[model samples]
Target: MLTHAERKRGIAWGLMSLFGITLFVGAPIIALLSWDMETAQTRLFTAYTWRILRFTLWQAALSTALSVAFAIPVALALARRPRFPGRLWIIRLMALPMGLPVLIGALGLIGIWGRQGIVNSLLLKLGLDQPVSIYGLSGILLAHVFFNLPLAARLLLAALERLPAEYWLLSASLGMKPLSVFRFIEWPAAWRVIPGVAGLIFMLCATSFTLVLVLGGGPAATTLEVAIYQSLRFDFDPPRAIALAFLQIAVTALILIVIASFPAPDDTGSTAGRITRRFDGRTFSALFWDALVILLATTFLILPLASIVTAGFKASLWGLVTSTAFLHAARTSFAIALAAGLLTILTSLAIVAAREAIADMKRPGRAARGFSVLLSGTSYLVLLVPPVVLGTGWFLMLRPLGDVTRFAPALVAVINTLMALPFVMRVLTPAIETHRKRAGRLSASLGISGLSRLWRIDLPVLAKPLLTAFSFAMALSLGDLGAVALFGSNELTTLPWLVYSRLSSYRTNDADGLALILGVICLGLAILGTAGQREASRG
Candidate 1:
């Protein structure tokens, strides 16, 4: 029933997907295999390795616990008070950290919590004997909480919003107490989603590189990711780096498997008519507590962003704008982002198309379902292979062929594409699947196929999701520090690299200015992506 052209297109896309996965995921893994097993084994068993691994696990657990604990109250407050002033803006602001560069967020945290930060400044003015420091374990925890608290709050709030109206009505009719209502209703709903959220936050913190690298003041604060960087770039020990990379992958894979056991949080469902009429939290004390929670959450999320804007403007905006190095880095970042974004979108489309083609077959068998699963799962494989590990593996693979620095930019772009794959799939799959479901039979009846069918059907419907996915991919690549960190040199620097370089050399002003620029660009891309989604919804 399929036309020759359609069959050809499907085959081509399937092949393309295979090629991309092989090139990006397989190559580095193959490269890692080139190392001697005995050397890698020896490196893996050292006390230093075990210590770093333990620290990584400890910090991630603490961060996940703190983030989730703080988020519950804040999410409850947000859910209870849906009509509060600036509520929508606060929700949007919660997402800012998603698009904000890690280095920029770190800078903002330092500005507010560092030894000379406002809190410490106030303490000093009060004649306090000791100043606080935004370095080491505390700093790592603070940064992770700042980045993930909003995410957890948003997810929990969405979950709360999706609760049925009947539950609130039942509680109100029964005159249930606040404690009783939460025990009977909210706790059950939230418990289902917490594992997934916690797992994601833990993995993010565990694999944290940029924030830890900047704030980790000494060896005591180093994470597995930073250690891997040091092993390859500083120590020039390929075996040690390979061993660490393998350890990181194993730990991440185990976490993913655990997370898979939980019911995945559904973000795409309609919550429009689901707002429950709450009978709890009506007392003055309850109201005050909720208001206090919302205010504190808002302050925690917004103050660092405000600090970045103020510090950047006051310090070196003009000098940074006019500097040659800054311009080159910006250009490099832009090019890489553009290239990576396009590549991610194209590759995602191919894999998605192949899956659709499989589904469109007259009789999809076990093989078809398995292939579809493989296609979907390939995107997630990138999660297990951390960017640092991938970069290290590729470095080892390429070192013998030629100068690896020459290929750094391309490799960074490829790695960024891989990192963006999961996100791109999330955005595209739903749209593409909906389109195919709605129109596939009709297209088949009319014998529409290939470019004709695509142009007439798919493109018009998919334009918005495609654009949104591209913008998100670009934003992610633009702000990426991990992929570029291993390959960054004078000849191949990005804006993030420039910001980090300035920070390393103690050029705080320049770093602040560059951070601001990078943050603004990323924010713009995020806005662009969301704008398309908003328009699509309205249409």
Candidate 2:
């Protein structure tokens, strides 16, 4: 019953997903095949690789546990209060770390926790000779917690927020104790999200490159991703690099598989800023604890960003805006980010469209479930293969051709596209699914098919989500320092690279200024992406 164009669209989407598979999976395979077995073997048994492997698992575990443990209390505090000062902004604050650049967050954390940072400075003023060091496992853990805590908290809070209002009413009518209420109500909702959230955090921490590289001081604290980079760039050992990459690929793939087994928690239910009435906490002690939790969490999140603004403002303008290097890097960053954004959104839509087509071609139960799993799995494969692994694979494949730097833009854009796919899809899929469910039959019945259907129907209805997805993807691409680190050169410099470069050269003021500018641009895009929009009417 499908039109010719509809069938074609389905095929096109299927091809796109296949293309994703080839790019992510096939590229790495190509790299592995090209590996020098002698060199790889020599490095494989080294104590360093094993150390890195152990540390990678260790840091990731610690980060996931800490992020989830701290997040539960914060989520509960926010959920139970229902109405509190600055509640809306606090909710919005959780979204910042997701879109914020890792480099920027690192900068913020350093300004707060680094040797010269505010905390250590305060410690020194208190007459302590020992300084706080962020150059080891400690820094890696702190930064991971800073980034992942808000994400975990938001997931738990959303799950709590999505609970039926009647649950609270029943709890109230039954006069359930606080412990009983949480056991029967809030715990169940939050538990559903924890496994997937923890898995994701583990994957993120394991694949962490920029943060680990910047904060990791040296070999003593290296993770597998960082080890891979060190092997390639510092040691110039291709075999070691590929060996470490192989390990990283295995680790991330296993985590991604685990994450996929858990059903994705639904986030489509919006509370619309409406606070659900609660009767569990009216005691003075409860109020004090909630206040303390919210305050400490907010302060931890805000200070680094605040320092960026303050230090950036004090920076000499002559060194930043007027510099030709900074200007060129800014242009290059914007161009790459836009390209990555377009690709991420387009690829996501294609994957979802392919699934929709399959739905039309088959019956609704097990078949639909299979397609759902397939398409969802496809969207997440990118997360399985980290950017450095993907980029390194492409680098090896292209190195035989000509100068790899010539293809840097293309490679970096592709890597960013893959890296952002999971997030962008998470943002856009629900809207697309909602649109199709509400209007698909109607549009098909009206003979609205093909380009006409897309132009007249899909575009108008999905405008906001599409735009939001584009902005979010752009922000993430704009901020990423992953593949670019491997491929970056004098010819291709991004704002993140430039900032890192300045920081490396001891130009702290310049680094601060660039970080601020980059932070502002990212923050602007993130705000645009996360801004709430009313759903488009079927009319």
Candidate 3:
């Protein structure tokens, strides 16, 4: 029943899937194979390895707990005071950290909290002589919370928004106190979403690289990812690097498995046309407390960004802008981001196309369904293999062949593409599925297939999602430090690398200028990505 063009498309998609598996999965496996079991086993059991593993787990646990704990009260306050002035803008500002580059955010954080920074300056003026250091475990936690609290709040807020109107009405009619209402209504709804959200935040913290690298002041503060970087780049010990990578993979796999065991929060029931109003938190004392919580949270989120802007403008912007090194780094970053974005989109389309083709079959067999699922799940493989681990593996593979620096840019692009694949899949899959369901048969019935069907039918409908995916992929690539950290050199420096270099060399002014530029570029791309969705909705 399939047309010749359809068959060709399916075959092409299958080949693409094979290529992805070979490149992403097989390449790492081959690199790890270079390690002898005796050395790997010995390295794994060393005290140093255990310490790194423990620190990684401990920091991730603390970060997840704090982010979720702080987010709840903020989310509650926001949900109850929906009509407050600038509430929407506050929510939008919270989302900035999610898209902002890690290095830029770190710079912003240091500007406010570092020694001789804003906070320390204030303390010194007030006769508090001990300057605070934004380095070590405390700094790591602050940065993690900064980046993740907003995400948790937004997720919790959405969950709060989806609560049944009946529950709110009952609580209001009974004159329920805030505590009682939270216990009886809000807690139940929010609880379901918490596990998945916590798991997600936990994974993010566990795999953190740049934050730890920049804030971790000494050997005691290093993470497994940083240790992996140190081992490969500084120590030049392939056996130890492979051992650590294996350990990281094992830990990541375990976390993923545990996360998978939790039931996803159900948003199946309808709550449309529900007007939300809370009876609690209206008293003088309650209002003051809630308002105070909101204010503190807002200040925490905004002050660092404000400092970045203030300090950046104070710096010699023109000098930094005209610097050849800065311009070269910027150009290199753009080229890599563009290449990564395009490749990510292409790979995502291939995977999605294959899954759809199989699913749209007249009667797909169990094997076909399983294969489709596998294809759809391919992007998540990148998540399991952290970018640092992937980059290290590739470095080992290439070291024996040629000067690795010659291929650093290509490697960075490939790694970035892989990292962006999961996000691209999330954006593209639903759109692709909906379009196929609506138009696939129509095209086949008309004997229109392949490029003809694509150009006339898919392109018009998919333009928004495609562009959104590309923008996100590019933005992610632009801000990436994990893959580039191991490979970046004078010949292959990126904007983020340049910022780090400036910071490392005590060139605070230059770092500030570059951080400002990087943050603006990332924020712009994120806006572009969201704009496409807004346009599609308006149309």
Per-candidate Cα lDDT values, in order, are 0.88, 0.83, 0.86
lDDT of 1 at 95: 87
User: What is candidate 2's lDDT per residue for 1-539, written digit by digit as tens?
Assistant: 35667857775876777666666667666776677867887888888889899999999999999999999999999988878678989877877777789998898888889888999999999999647888898999999999999999888888998887778888999999888988999899999988988988888888888999899988888898878777766777788888888788788878877887986755555466544688877788888888899889989888987888888888976668879998999899999999999988878888878777766774657755676577777766667677777777777777889888999997888788887888788778888888988888898789888888889988987888888889988888888888798888899999999999888888888898899989988888866764646333432
Backbone clashes under 3 angstroms, per model: 0, 0, 0
Specify the poorest-scoring 10-residue window by lDDT in model 2.
530-539
What TM-score, computed on C-alpha atoms, does each candidate reach? 0.97, 0.92, 0.96
Q: What are the per-residue Cα lDDT tens digits for candidate 1 across 224-304?
A: 999999998888988888889999999999989988888887765336676557777889998999999999999998999
Candidate 1 segments exceeding 4 Å error: 1-4, 269-275, 536-539
Number of the top TM-score candidate: 1
Best by lDDT: 1
Candidate 2 positional error at 510, Å: 0.7
lDDT of 2: 0.83
Q: Ranking under lDDT, best-scoring first? A: 1, 3, 2
Worst 10 residues of 3 by lDDT: 262-271
Better of 1 and 3 by TM-score: 1
Instruction: Quantify how close model 2 is to the true structure by its C-alpha RMSD in Å.
Output: 3.0
| Candidate 3: tens digits of C-alpha lDDT, residues 136-235 | 9999999999999999888888888887677777888898888898898888878989999899899999999999999988779988899999998788
